[model samples]
Target: MTTISKTRIDGMPIGLTLALLLACAVNLAVLARWL
Candidate 1:
């Protein structure tokens, strides 16, 4: 996942970047809620 994200970061489209950011934000939010 890290490898793919890194590559996406390097050459992926802005849409993908936004999607990745959104995914991270959702993950963090879920973790925060759980904790």
Candidate 2:
């Protein structure tokens, strides 16, 4: 997720960045649960 981080550093809005991070975390959690 270097691209995401770069975008965040490049001044992407905080809300959108937080949403993306939250979504990623949720997705990983779901996958871990399923596996």
Please tell me which predicted candidate would have the highest lDDT against the true structure.
Answer: 1
lDDT for each residue of candidate 1 in 1-35, tens digit (9 for 90 to 100):
99986886989888988998999999999999999
* Deviation (Å) of 10 in candidate 1: 3.2
| Model 1 poorest 10 in a row by lDDT | 5-14
* Candidate 1 ranges with C-alpha deviation above 4 Å: 1-8
Question: Mind sharing the TM-score for model 1?
Answer: 0.72
Please give the lDDT score at residue 8 for candidate 2. Answer: 64
Deviating ranges (above 4 Å) for candidate 2: 1-5
Q: What lDDT is reached at residue 31 by model 1?
A: 100
Q: Candidate 2: give the clashing pairs.
A: none
